[model samples]
Target: MGRTKRKRLKKYEQNSINLCYEEHLVSLQKWMSNKGWKNHKKLSLKLFPETGRGISSKITVGANEVLLSIPMNIMITYTTVKLDIPVKNIFTIHESLALFLIKEKEKGINSYWRDYINSLPEKLPPLTWLANEEEIESFPSDIKLNVEYTTTNFKNFLNKIRDFIPNNSTLADSLLKWAYVMVNTRAVYVDPHIICEESSLNLLKDEPSMALCPFLDMFNHNYLSNTEVSIINEGRCLFYELRTLSSCKKYEQIFISYGNHDNVKLLTEYGFFLPDNCYDNIKFTLDEVLKILKFNLDNNKYKFIKEHDLHNNLYIGYDGVSYNLKAVLFIGWCGVINRLDSIIFSSNYPSLFLEKKLPDLIKGLLVIKKNEFTNDLRQIMSGRIVTESAQMVLEFVKFRIDFISEVILEYR
Candidate 1:
């Protein structure tokens, strides 16, 4: 007798038909209504209940005749309970709602959601056309505007990275390390026109708009792949897309329960964490940490001592928490990378580079040294500060020395 073949439905086929039916929709609608989603009209209810690529259900809701599409995914993983939701809902509905619904909810929102929302906007005018000659002339022009990476410099940087990675560092570690030097050493000039709406308007002679998110900068996978992604006309609202995955525990449970035994073996062979679903969580956590750091820096609570008089070694303390020199610089650099043509820096001040790029570079360097250090001698140079140049240099050198010494001692 021939061996019996067991019949089974394909994953997508199962998902297409796995709709929760009217009963579940009604319950969900009620839940939405309770959460103040008034004037809800069910546009269309589609389902893909299976766990795989693009496996999700989309519910379009009409509120006061405004159509809002809600795409949701239920992921079963080992370490987390994951629910992918639309970013607009966080602003439109309630951020706390997702947390309340998901059991054993993780600590933070998925980074993909932010990316998705940010990518949804239409492209705005470039920054070069926005400013007048007088207005633009008033801005700093001393900072090197268009520094390009030479082939030799790029290769040298890559070699340095490769040399460090042999110590068993992860991809994120290497990338972070590179980003620090790229920004600080002025190996690459961050275009100021890309940083802010006012700057974009003034420098580019274009209407003010926000910058798009760069792909390299945005490592999260769930961001909508094919959106224009830009800022609003007023430059206040930014949007993008995001897709989230199941938690590690939930993913493993689903994989095992669904008889995907080979997946476990394959993941193991690739040196991946057994619970593959946790990757998204890790990425999100890192992004959140960076954002928090940016926020703290912007608020001025993070203080930086600026040398006002280089000759007298006189220094003035600039509070990052209340004032935003560094934050402005960072935002500007990020904007430039996003290719937002509508933003520009008017002034040619080299000091902006020092203010905006150095702190984060230092922080990133510390992180790398702590994780992977091989006695590679590194030196950083600062611009001359006539008023407090000596003091600033001394403080910067001391900070770096202390940090390096601490890391070396700790690892030793």
Candidate 2:
């Protein structure tokens, strides 16, 4: 039965790919033209190996060439929502956009944005989709906590806004949540107030400045991508292109940097993570460290540390553990050894904290984090195909553990 489910999933994926080739790309171009999109002749959407669908060039795209120039009138923004959707009061811009998307999605082919809407996944593969509570809990505490928080927030938001929708409106919690995430992940920041007040969305007095750009959102994220998106024509228009695409060969995929985001940020917000991410950091909280300590800290010591902001300095980056983390641990150790004189501990502690005992304490903390990560990886690998979202998270954990293990070896 499990094998059959896997086979079915594989077949669906192949069909989805085929559908993109045979229908989505062609229809998308036609729809965009009908909607008055300009400056997209040189680009074409194509599915590449490993990476999913992204815009590619048939001919060589020169540096500084504007690959896409979308007019302000066509963008899905606060103005579009205020005019089209009948929802009386939107608490936030995201909820407003999510409501609009849900209404349009229910319209099927009748909706003007049908082609683009259909191109989107029926549902995202966010960690919120994990069916088993245990599977969700198996993730690192940070990740698990984030997923729960976001899920709870979505549910609360949906409940708050659903009453405004008419009884005749079709509002599914799942679809509404998916639409919310779509807007959250794909929307780009743009100061709509810069547009002429005549064309601006004045009704939404408190709405955030963001817009959903078709075709542009399709580009996958690359931390090192040279592409830059900028506003032009008094912020009434937006354009993006590769800054150094002169070296790119024909049919090569063009990418854009989402932002200088870490793995945790990416996975939580975008449903993906980068392996060996240069920005990756393994964090340690003071609470966890306190729990792991063999000796109980006295009230005076705890109060002093808390008042002095001496907690939660631990973090492991690409360059191994941070020095601030070592200092905090050393201070705690000194307290444990009854050598923590308030005046002496405060003055020039960097050299003082580098004692022989410090490395052992740091090593022990690293080993504990490493073991936790190793146990999580074993459970993930032993399960059925974890999919890219889960796999990326697992790989990120493994990468951190490996880095920590190497740091421990350095202490040898």
Best by TM-score: 2
Model 2, 119-201: lDDT tens digits are 67666755533435655656777788877888787876667665555663457667877788889888887766653254445
In candidate 2, which residue pairs clash? Answer: none
251-310, model 1: which lDDT tens digit per residue? 111111111222112121111112222111101122333443443332221222122111
Per-prediction TM-score to the true structure, in the order listed: 0.17, 0.75
lDDT of each: 0.26, 0.65
**Candidate 2 lDDT for residue 109:** 84
Model 1 TM-score relative to the real fold = 0.17
**Global lDDT of model 1:** 0.26
Over 4 Å off in model 2, which ranges? 1-21, 34-36, 39-41, 61-65, 84-90, 126-130, 195-207, 234-247, 293-313, 323-327, 333-361, 378-400, 406-412
Candidate 1 backbone clash number? 67
